[model samples]
Target: MKQGTKGFVGADETGAGQGATGRARVPAQPGAEDVGRQRNRTRGGGTDAVPGRTGVDGVRGERTHSEPALPRPLPRRPVQRSSVRGQILAALRTALVTGELRPGAVYSAPVLAERFGVSATPVREAMQQLTLEGAVEVVPNRGFRVVERGDRELAELAEVRALIEIPVVLRLARTVPAERWAELRPLAEATIRASSSGCRATYAESDRAFHRAVLALAGNEQLVRIAEDLHRRAQWPLVGSTPGARDGGARLVADAHEHTALLDALIAGDPDAVRSLMEAHFTGAV
Candidate 1:
């Protein structure tokens, strides 16, 4: 888990915005403000509740001693563990990428548990992980809040992906084995099909897998891992359902055609044409 609290995943952009790019907004927990408001009310009531104030009943009107002695609400304690905590963390990570957890918003274990229909134990574990990742911040008395991302970071990530993958495509254009394309072409088609109608989660995975298949043909596991990391980090903003598009997923069919065209060039060992097409594909819409 990377710690910074200001970063989140990508969403499916073709479903909204200028093109196939969108942002995920983390959703805030419900009724988080109620607790503080309730406590404030008790402090605001009457002067008799104060130490030296005299009441209308005179003669040191009987105070409910227990009221004054009641313990104040304590800060939520951190949780420890890996399994259940990991599950919560996984859910939260998905939520962050899928736009369920909006940025700049905060949550507490109890609130998250209630929303998730689980115990605070897992939620706490998840939040701690998030704290370490810098996706969320833990306030002293208050609970966790989410971090916000800037435009520069987003654009740079896209640029970086283009820088790495475009070159690889150019290199592989004329060199990739015919057997590799035989294997990858169907996967690309499947990805296009999945993206058109499947759930965002499933579609996102397939979409990434298709790209990975192409990159893997280059035989650089290290580069593949780096790209995967970037993809994982962008999940929230790149995979979820957007508010204004029904045909967005359909556009992937066109992307599949682009893949096919690249494969055709590769089969013919046309490196220059491959480079030109691959760069245009990556930099054009994505």
Candidate 2:
């Protein structure tokens, strides 16, 4: 979000030059051309003036030519503390999902803050939020340690998501108009693009966006929030798994394609197709 000034200042052409401070120097007097000539001669040490000594005008070794000053660096806008905390929280979540922050590894807030180029306060705040989400636990005097999740826990999270989302999506497919479902096609397409990039973080966000859009049709704010939270938790990589492991990109692309298929089923007013696709999607997610 930092904006910087571009381009350098150019030298003036009408005998006016920029001073060392980047301000424009005063132009020579109109009728005093003779005086200007004499000053130039004195500067060149062609007259009685010494080259490096102070002149009669108290000026010392003034240059005869002007050099363009280097552009000053622009000041960066200060980031808000809340914004910093939110960003750190998001980054930590992505790291958890991608397995960059290995499970059971203790991470100090000060160390993380230094890596993020921010103060420890925001990182600690973000860590506290992650702790609340059960993503990490405090190690007292050490730091926060990532909580390892096994296959069973991941499967259970997926199962909970299926239980919450499948019925709601199926009900909406029957009552919601085709046009309403059609409007979500862009969000569904976004998942495919994100998956194709092979970035788990991008895919995770787009996947949640698509599901949240679909569930929003249910007209239940609480359900959407709860379902999204469960969806996020289910995205964390299994313990000891590396990023993009287990045919990651291929699996993501396959799951992303299912989104468009589910959208098609909803638009076609086929509740059976919607239910089957939803169940399969949840199953494949784990």
Candidate 3:
């Protein structure tokens, strides 16, 4: 970046993915690399490499054509064949949340493999897994596409969360020992700190952990899984918006308060109050 040049500077930790801090995780995608490549190609005009560090008559010059932007993680690390499928799935999940693969966008395994610099076998396997999860759609001959999320559908899912989770929190408040609440307070605080520091990924994780900790008291693995997935999928909207945007941040803060209230109600054995707070907690927008 030159003293008065107009341009962008972007840097991020390599390979951190969505677990970077503790808010809602932003799924990883290829935006940074792709955009940088496009910009360099466009500005340079010819196929010559844009030297990383250049000198002109002993004066260093790094031209810029945009404003400072968000950090972007480096390319993903290499993976073994055995875990390639899981890697692809993780990649796809990030892309979906980040809106890189828009709803209805067709997916071609071979093409995706090439895009990710991997083998098609793994890509195919990932597509199958995503299809089963209802995150994507498969056509007989057209391959797959990311599914469009409808507001009504999301609301319904949110309702289910309210029903299932609020009561559990209430019960846990009544039965779970006080020590457990003390143990989770740090996690919640850490999540808040992560969000304040603009570590959206970390904030998301901590947020999930806080909610999961509340539900863990129920001791129902199947219900827990369902709740986790629902919460994760609902993050798609936030990923499309700016990290820690005010609306999402406010919602998150409110959720934390709800957690506190639920805990209070649990410890007091106020089941009805707990259920009401829980309903309001999950049904609220992000």
Candidate 4:
């Protein structure tokens, strides 16, 4: 498993599907080398090469001016094939969360691969993973389309999360030591910084990190896993809003500050304050 800046979310050390860290463990694909060789052959003007277009350094060039431009600029960091699929998956998630990939828009693998400066195979694999996550869906013979989640769905997700997490957090506050709660202050502060930076993706990870760290103190791995999944689903960008929009940024900073307040309540061993703060936190999450 590759370590991301915010850390991988779900995969365990053995590459099993679930873990405390939340990073995914991707399986290796066979014939990746064959795919690379085929791409090279196409670039070299082999049978796969199209007429009137030349492949330059593995990217097809000389567009006929008929292709539509991407709706927004994608992160263009070039990546290598060694563990490339997971890397691309992470990048695509960041894009999705940050609104670089707009909802209801279609994006083909080749174009995204070109943007990432990698082969299409890894990009396709990454898209497939996104499909499983409900972040995007496959559009037959075209590309993957970002899923548009509505306010109702977001509200329902928040409700489910509250039902699951609020009680557990309140329970932990009564028993956990003040020092244990103190340890999480940095993560709470990190969320504030991420929100202030105006990067939704960064704030999303930090937000998750703070919550996961809090939940992990309960020593219930299964509970942590379940809560994390619900939390992630809730974090998806809502429809009809630009990524990091002004209101959204303000909401994020407000939410980020709640983490610290929640921590303070926990440290004070005040379950009443914890309950109140947690309720407000989830309510405002929508």
**Candidate with the greatest lDDT versus the true structure:** 2
lDDT of 1 by residue, 96-202 (tens): 75557777666778988998788987787778877776577887667887766654555666678888888787777657677767777787677667666634555
What are the per-residue Cα lDDT tens digits for candidate 4 across 1-286? 3676745344465567745576774665648677787667665556666665554344445543333555567768755664899899989989988889989999999999999999999999999988987899999999999999988988898889999999888888778889988998899999999989988889999999999998898899999998887887787787887878849579989999999988888898999999999888988893
Q: lDDT per model, in order?
A: 0.66, 0.86, 0.68, 0.84
Residue 94, candidate 3: how far off, in angstroms? 2.1
Q: Distance from true position, residue 175, model 3, in Å?
A: 0.6
Runs of candidate 1 exceeding 4 Å displacement: 1-90, 124-144, 238-257, 284-286
What TM-score does structure 3 among the candidates reach? 0.61
159: Cα error in model 4, Å = 0.6
Candidate 1 similarity to native, TM-score: 0.56
Error of model 4, residue 160, in angstroms: 1.0
Lowest-sum lDDT 10-residue window in model 1: 238-247
Please rank every candidate by TM-score, starting with the best.
Answer: 2, 4, 3, 1
User: On residues 183-281, what C-alpha lDDT tens digit does candidate 2 reach at each position?
Assistant: 999999999999999888899999999999988888899999999889988888778877676685899999999999999999999989988998999
Instruction: Tell me the alpha-carbon RMSD of every candidate.
Output: 22.6, 15.5, 23.4, 20.1
Of candidates 4 and 3, the better by lDDT: 4
Model 2 sits at a Cα RMSD from the real structure of 15.5
TM-score for all predictions? 0.56, 0.71, 0.61, 0.70
Top-TM-score candidate index = 2
Poorest 10 consecutive residues by lDDT, candidate 3: 49-58
